[model samples]
Target: MSQMRLSLDQLTGTNRRAADILLGNDRGGYTVPSAKLYPFQWNWDSALVALGFSVFDSDRAWQEVESLLSAQWDNGMVPHIIFWKEEKSYFPGPEQWGTTDIAKTPPTSGITQPPVAATVIERLLAEDIDAHRDRAAKLLPKLDRWHQWFLDARDPDGRGVVAIMHPWESGRDNLPDWDRPLSFIDTTGVGTYHRRDTDIVNKDERPKNDDYDHYMALVRFGRDCNWNTDHIARNCPFWVAEPGMNAILRRAERDLINMATLLGQDDIAARATARLARLDAGFEQLWSETVGGYVTLDLRRDEHATGLTSGSWLAMFAGPVEPARATKMAATLTYWLSQVKHGVPSFDPNHELFDSIRYWRGPVWAMINWMIATGLIEHGETDLADRIRRDTQALIDQSDFREYFCPVTGRGGGGTDFSWTASMSLYWAA
Candidate 1:
């Protein structure tokens, strides 16, 4: 309805192929045969893809989360990746998980990712046709139940903030900022492992064999524990308080509350109201007066990222940061994003751990940019907001929907003709 700036009709042949990947690969329901770098059913990928589907099918949007949510463990934790099959390219498949009879995996990652599913669902419902909204209204109770899973499982500290279960869940893989904390866990014992992702994609584009070994070592620990919930909550190397994870959690709470009211679920709405206040208070406290913005979680000590990332820009999405806090956040976002030759490096360039090409290290993901742009727009910083929006639109138009991009040159990075990027380009750029 907001008149698409880039129409579906205008999409070039490559973009058409990119958008259709989901429909084409959509197995049975939400099943996606992902790239080897990320072979499992990724949480955020599914959520974003569902957002695209809502443009056409609202019922399916809810099902996207429902399918993932249905996979939630009894403890309320939603694993980051769900493996549906055994493959050569992917390591740590459900077979590797060895938890609950690999065949009946109830979602695989012992850890959680950023809680974007609820927020995406909430937004989808808001945009739905009257009948779809009515359907979401009926499903509101179930949605609230899913949000509770995050609150109960991830917020081990009860600081009203959630901690991420793994770096993979952050949708940022191998960021340098995570290096120091991860060093504490001795990964030499991760045992013999096979990698499937490398088989399908260029090896250079994926994590190195050594890093895969380390990633597997930790996961093997999970399998040894049968993906033990209690052990994972305490011992995992990557269980830090991810800034994006928490920011999305904030949005999820607020949206869940609104969703509650939409469906006349007063009691649940009241709980969400309180939860939103609690998380907001903790978020403002993470503001770094020294660096001037929200800090990403290190997980080991439970503090912010040692340096800056786009995670700081995510504060804009969390509804409201106090004015002084927001000013610091905005200043941090502007200064840091400008420092990268690539426009928005994953980790601070000043940090020794910066890797421009690693999956989540420095690649500028279109989805994250969309969140940042839309978040800033909501805060009324229209100029900068429009700058990212237009620039992102230009990138998609030029490179044509990549899995990720090099912000410096604006060339596509990682996988090409990625589906969610193409769909979000239509929805968000619109």
Candidate 2:
């Protein structure tokens, strides 16, 4: 292990506590994103969780990835949530999805989340090439298919940036970026359904009642189309080409290019490189000089989103950007860091919709901090990156591995003992 990894392991109390929380959340092959709020293996959560496991248990890390892949759709789309076994704790379970009839695997959500698998795979391979090579090779084709699915199904107009049909797919369900597009979506026709999430976390911290109505409306819309990608791409009410998903997809595409070249798959490497270039070019459309960073675009409305959000910061993480633009984005991040006690609040502190205690509205998610910090480092802002890493660790240390932290008070909120929080703590601490 490197000196840094050794020092991280030596932080006895914090490291020990983080490891325990991670293992406690583990359910055989996959780890739940959290205990009560999110009980299933979530797509991006598992990928990030695996990166945490790679720090110590390489085998378990690979198992997390393999388990997620086991549910991959034949169409190459990997659903966002996998209902590994029946559980009553969560809402909109497999029954609501009505996808089993058409799906290739067991019950899973039809929509997909951010593609972080390629980034995680690259991390695992970097750790132990000899041990992970075979597994990485096995994962290549599946990851390729998943990437291809996004390009083919989500990006209808051949724009490198793809539209996320559901708020859930953006992974920032209630972020202000989607509000305008979501406003256009008519949810009155969708009937009531009991939400299990509020029971686990504060209703105020979660998406509001109206938000849920619109969310279910989108779900019902997709279900009625039998989760057919083509139809949903062409007709879904809430089609948004947001920055977060596009940034992550491009980052993943670039990583896949590296992995493919290592495996001597020239064809895959070529395709990934081409896709990455297109994504970088397409991101130009998302840039908002007024916001001083990339903002979500409501493709359906053909208008820029209302507020600056943490999701906008993800453009730094996706890959390289022009140096001048990156410098300005860094300056924008510095301004945001100064506005809140915690760095990288999910929503801009100055925004009208900012809610420090709410989940995505303004809380500082550890995972988000890690991504943005890492990206900042890659973009030559090591000082900012280090500050973010320290802030994230301090939050977990002070608040104890909660799902999200309040930006103003730094108090942990939402689900306690969250898997990704613990995982990211381990990662950033290292």
Candidate 3:
């Protein structure tokens, strides 16, 4: 399992480059995923970007989270994108969201991304508790409320798992897991709107126009409902219980409980424990022996979304799964690894829909690799974990810090100098 380690000079060079990317992307308190492509501060991006900042500037890392949390909605749900300043480069801007009245100071999209903040905060505090203790204390209650919002708004049924109303919420964008659910969404009246992403990156490397139509339709629906969770839940056609999003939420809740316990917040810890128990039980619905991995549950059809995605492996990372299931997932991961030069393709490389150059179809993202490897190590699948970590570092070394790399060719794709890509390189690629 031995792999090449970066020489002292190489290690310093990698860290310096990553730090420069983080600093270049920084916009006051928050960091953008990319300067031209994303422009706005994204939910999960900031959380991961904070980790990279912690490596060089601990104080800046704390400010990143604080700035993101400042835009939390009244209902405890954090918006997926915060329109901190006017930016015309990206599509579906603040006006498209039509949430000015409801959103906080800068205004934001109504939808929420994965809850990676609590897990990230715990890691930050662990690095330097004495310096970050006060920040963690203040963030815990807000994080608690944000976690509770999932239970109240997204999973009103008290089903241990929460449902993502939009693909953007999953943060995988064009993942094949949403294909079937997205197909059911009617884009008849989505109307005309320009997309700025394809303008910045090759359209071939980005999501198809058909995907955007469905995405925009969902956005319009949310806006029409005034971003009301209850209304969207009762009527929206695209409701899915995604394994990846749930795993992230579950892991965050687990970490939140630990953070609360450390901060002596017994009440927060107790509530998070109850929430985690339900999530642990409900997560079973996502497991599909048919796919040999955890798949998405289309709530509308009451059936599982058929596909083998990198997300399934997240269950192990977010686990307490039975040993048998973890072994099965590990085997599936190994099979996928054998099919590509880079490990952990976003979608199964053998799947008919897999396209190595397309975003979230079959590309390898460093952030995903970091999580999968971390989960593998936790489950004692160190050999496979090391393989993934090695492959990830190789991709970065050969391709530079791009948004993602082609699993088959190891070529970089999407936006260049991506924030989370650089962040993961610094924090996990070492």
Candidate 4:
């Protein structure tokens, strides 16, 4: 470990305070992303939270992963929002997302977010195999089912690349990449409903009103389909193949295969290996030479988004790309770092739709930085990786653990005392 990592392990007043923030956000068995902006156990947020817990409390870390998977759907698809309890602090609650048609699981959003559970599980196990083995046994089969669900539902065409039926599924609720496909969605059926996100975070920091309209429009569509996976996949108006979701899923699938191998589950290992081959080939369809990074394909329209965002940078992190492709991506990342004080901006600053404060459009998220940094390190770009870690640490220290940061100004934006931001800070410090 580096000197900074040694210092982090020593536990200063700052570390104690960061831990307090995490504990403060802990609702009970699980932690919410935050108190006001997000009041439920979110899929991806819980995975990241597990990493932070592993830094100090390994048992709590494993429990966090266990709690997240406790709500897994029978089909293996882990719903995005697991409404552990009712809270009116956020919009599109359990009532809004009627998942009763899907299964008798906990109240959850019909659509799933990026699957990072396997990746988190692999990391925790790396810290202690003997301690996490039994838990890993329980999780591996469910994870295999989840991966199977993605293939069966999202990649029906056998393109190897899965499609996101809703923007929220991408975990980037309103990225410019979806603007084109979202426009085609009919919000006329969306009844009178209030948005609770704007109530807590700045309106400028959230998705635009039009984006929300389409978001709700898709929600209504899912509900109309009765949350039937086959029905929704066949008829959904919006279908975006996001690089971030693809990358995360790719990494998770790879990790799950490794875990499955250790557990003597050869069936899952074989299936995951086959899926990896398909994903490797399908990536060609999403490659955008003009953008200098992999871009998303609006599968519904059979069109590709030209805009480059943080999601595109995630391709390298997902897995190895062609050396030439990785070299170009490295150049692209270096170019963006030159444009802003921050190493990665959510969207390219040169793009007309880029917004410094608005969520997903153009903000540097700590979680994203941590992921991109890890990718950079794996690709042997240690300088950029170190820069990202340093920048993330400095920004969090200056901003007091806000949700995201302004890439150009290094100022915090969105909800404060955020769980993932705190989680990333602790990881970066270590």
Candidate 5:
């Protein structure tokens, strides 16, 4: 295994270089990883990327989110990605949504992407200096309203768990987990749409066509309707639960509750408490006791199903899985490790549909490794946690952040220099 300190030094160097632009006086807030792909504002990517910015300039870290937050709609929803002042051709720019009810004028979404802003805010506040703290102090009030919108608009049933109106809201963009549910939609009339992903990246490196079809269909549906929620909710695809995403929301709700409590927003704090209860129950419905892991639900499927994704470990983030269930989960993960050449395959390797080179089919991702390791440590599987940590570190040390790894050989597969993978090194080290 590579020395932790040496690995840390390598990580810190990348963090510092990225921070120079993120926190530097010379640049605004843009420091995205994909020059070709992003070339514009990405809502959730920049939110998490800013956490690394905090280690350098807490002020800049706060601004990164502020740039995103500034675009919040009157309904308090933060859109997934925002095009810049001049970059309109960024495929599916707000211009394409002129038919939808959302501000085709500015294209601000009346829905949220992910709830990471609050978590990032909470972390920054806990570690920031007076200047950093002051920025967060100012941001706290604004972020609170956005967080409240999540409870208000997305919660739908007043359950603490928030549902995503579109799969893009999860920001995973075409995970097989969403496919079966997304397939029920009729996309016959959306007209022809072009995909840019398969252009620069190989088709094998991208999501399945069915996934692409559903995604573009949904986006077109939203764009055609001007992003009207009541209209879309009635006719479009809305996912009731995604364990990995809802797991993050469960945690974000907790963070917002703490922030609200600190800011004297008792009503909001109480609402968050009640929401947590619902999400906790929501998780139980999604768990499979016999399989010993959590699976995603297709609110569209009308029945609970087995997904066997690395996402099963999301239960760990929600906190202790029931003891019997956690043990089963532990075994299920172990079973997957035994099947794949990589320590953990993205999907159960034995499954017929597993595809290591394709996005989210079956490949080891550094971030997923980070989450599962945390899950492992949480479930009295510390030995396995250490094993994951060592393996992940070894992978990064050899060549940082390849999109996916061969399921059976640990051969680096798919894209390179992915932002989240680099950040995984820091978060896992911490």
Candidate 6:
């Protein structure tokens, strides 16, 4: 039997539809993840969306990133969600974050998301250095400050890896990797709060009520502390070192180091080089031979959280694992791929906790697949990488641009016309 592939016409249609999604979601300088569901410009979503815009609109791509950076806090931490303007649709709104006094301009959430901007900037710059050099030059120091903020605030111990105070920070909300650590958090004072997400999307497709309870409780805790890192680190109940987030930061540091060197920012390059070394060594603590892949560390408990999720595969994308470990991860990934028609379920499909329709438990995210495939290619797993790319394209073909797809059914779930989904599809189809 011959393998299926997207025809030239289909590829062109995909690109056009993806561009339309970005255009539709565009709100002047930045793009929202989705119109009604997300509304606000998210930290990581904008970074990824910028990459998507770079495909056809270079100016818009740079604008997307610049808008996101404009919300950077005085302390250098870029808030996860920048509320350029208030929208009633989103819960845990700017008021909940209480960052008006602390955050810049339009206000933002107190927490930061996975730092993917540096990596995205590097890619954009590589595509057209002359076109983006000046923009990259101006953004370079701000990006450096953001990374340094992580080192100083999240990794006060200089552990090479940073700890995420909330699951949202890892950008893998409701991931099973956080189950144990989140369980330790008490939601006694969470109070009554309505979640706009469940109201807009299917309740089953979103994080459970209990998850929201814990989420808001943590939000309140941060609000109480004025979103101070030292205070949160000292008292927050949910502190975990996520492999996926660390891998992202590690990869971004590598990219940032290159960007700094290219832009003649030697001091920033040297600092990032040293930080990358620490991150490379830090992976040792995250690896679990039992799981046969990297796992999240419960920083509060000072123990490894046992679970094999898609995040475990991000180490491949981050690219510092030993050859033997990378080989083992490839084999393990192959085994996981075999369990479902679609590739790279967020949670191992075989796991009892796996929920195909749920937000993150077992959904197949295009962004995850793209990152994993890129890592595979870097690690010389070209065949596996190609397989993932094909799977990703198949997912997009089967379902339009949605937040995520069910690995078992290839049906879209969560918010529709998702910016990052469309962004990744554009890249995959290209």
Best by lDDT: 3
> Against the hidden reference, what TM-scores do the models get?
0.88, 0.97, 0.97, 0.96, 0.84, 0.96
Model 5, CA-based lDDT: 0.63
- Give the alpha carbon lDDT tens digit for every residue of 1-430 in model 5: 1112222235455444333333332136644545554455667767766665655455666778888777776666677766554453345555554533554444543345766677777776666344355565666656656666666666565544566767778765656677667767776766666666566567877776677667667777777776666565556665556677777667677777777677566777787677777777766767665544677766545455456777667677556677877777777777777776556666767777777767677777776676567667777899777777777656655555555566665666555555555555554533
lDDT (Cα, 0-100) at 313 in candidate 1:
79
Judge candidate 3 at residue 197 and give its lDDT: 92
Model 5: lowest-lDDT 10 consecutive positions: 1-10
TM-score of 1: 0.88
**How far out, in Å, is residue 93 in model 3?**
0.4
Candidate 5 local lDDT, residue 75: 66
Candidate 5: list runs displaced more than 4 Å. 1-27, 85-90, 99-111, 129-131, 158-161, 238-240, 262-267, 375-380, 411-415
Off by over 4 Å in 6: 1-11
Best-to-worst order by lDDT is 3, 6, 2, 4, 1, 5
Clashes of 3: 2
lDDT of 6 by residue, 1-430 (tens): 0112333234357787888899999999999999989999999999988877877777888999999998888899998999888699999898898988998579899899999999999988988798789999999999999998988899988877899998899999999888888888889988888889988999989999999999998999999989989998778899889889999999999999999999899999999998889888987889877777789998888788667888889997786668888888899899998989988899989888899989889999888888888898899999988888888889888988899999989999999999998888775544
lDDT of each: 0.66, 0.86, 0.88, 0.83, 0.63, 0.87
Q: What TM-score should be assigned to candidate 5?
A: 0.84
Residue runs of model 4 more than 4 Å from their true location after superposition: 1-10, 101-105
- Show model 1 residue runs off by greater than 4 Å: 1-18, 31-40, 101-107, 336-343, 349-352
Clashes in model 6: which pairs?
Answer: none
